[model samples]
Target: MIRVVLTDIEGTTSSLSFVHDVLFPYAEEHIGEFIKNGFSDNPEIQEQLEAVAEESGVSANDLDGLIEVLQTWIREDRKETPLKMLQGMLWEQGYQSGAFRGHVYSDAAEALRSWHDRGLRLYVYSSGSVKAQKLIFGHSECGDLTPYFSGYFDTRVGLKRDPESYRNILDQIGVAPDTVLFLSDVEAELEAAETVGMRTALLVREGPLPETSRPVMRDFDEVDALLRKR
Candidate 1:
């Protein structure tokens, strides 16, 4: 039985354009000012800077160059830990400043709340940083969906396409892999999860399947049905 459901945000429960066109650009526009004003003093920023340097093969002394590199990473939607963290920080300002609220599909919000009520452990596994995950849910259009989740995980745990990551999360949760259902828009991510013995569902939310055949659903309602049948 599926006891836990882990969902991806962008392109899974949310529109990809919302993240790429809205969230990302907002971060890019204000990141320079945010960083220049010593936002790096934030513990999260400091940690991410170190991570970014390691990922970019650059040094801290090259902040300007690193910023440029990060912009490129954002454009490419690279799942670099550092870039994801920085995006979280930039998003924090946006969320707090009332720039833009997190976008969540109404169906997603409804299903998530219902699933939580049913006592199914819900977790998030996004390429987005954990902070970003919290921010999106906490400031979500549905309002503070974070409390509904049992935990949040990001790329820090492992690459989404690497089965080892799913294995690690399963180990951490102390659950039988078959009881854990992982929802994502990417076939590779689902493939990895399945490899680790977890149940997988493709969220075909107004997009093409992830270039591979796998169990697929248009939304959480279908997922709920699948789980019920189990």
Candidate 2:
């Protein structure tokens, strides 16, 4: 009786090439200038900077060092909260300046809408910041799909591989763990969700994983079948 479906974005509901090849490069190209010229004085920006400094036990005044650290985090695709927040801020400027719209697969958009209409509780769980999640769907190619989500979560809560994060999400949604279906391309993420007693499915868009830890499917069509079985 899966009532809630939590989906990952980068490589599950959308394409990995879009995230790695397109979005990441766009952010990398614009980040420096965006940080220098955009609203760094914004309260959210200041808060995240302070958080980064606190986490690293470094001085917030060290702007150059901070920028260097952030750039390194970007290269590694680290799920550091500060890096995610900064990326979201930089992406905001890119979105508003008509630089590029966030990418969403047509299949994803259509399936999400159909699922929502069928009364399934849809949520997003991504390493990307919650703001980034909203920005992606809000400016999606299919157009403003934010309304389809019941909630959004990011690494600010906890690391994706930590079972406690899935526990927290289940608690927040007030649903029985088994009734929540977690969808992600990463096996570890699914492992964490299953640890929290949630149903799990691997989105195998990137090809077969080295180890088949759970039920693997090529696309949402297979996932649709699995959901229908319940």
TM-score of 1: 0.93
Cα lDDT tens digits for candidate 2, 88-203:
87887777777777788787788788889989999999999998899989987789999999999998678999999998898889999999999998888999899989999988
Q: How many clashes show up per model?
A: 0, 0
lDDT value for model 2: 0.84
Residue 77 in model 1: lDDT: 79
lDDT, candidates in the order shown: 0.85, 0.84
What's the TM-score of every candidate structure?
0.93, 0.93
RMSD of each: 1.8, 1.7
Write model 1 residue lDDT over 133-230, tens digit each, in one string: 99988998888888899998899889999999998898888999999989988888888999988988888877455555567899878888988898
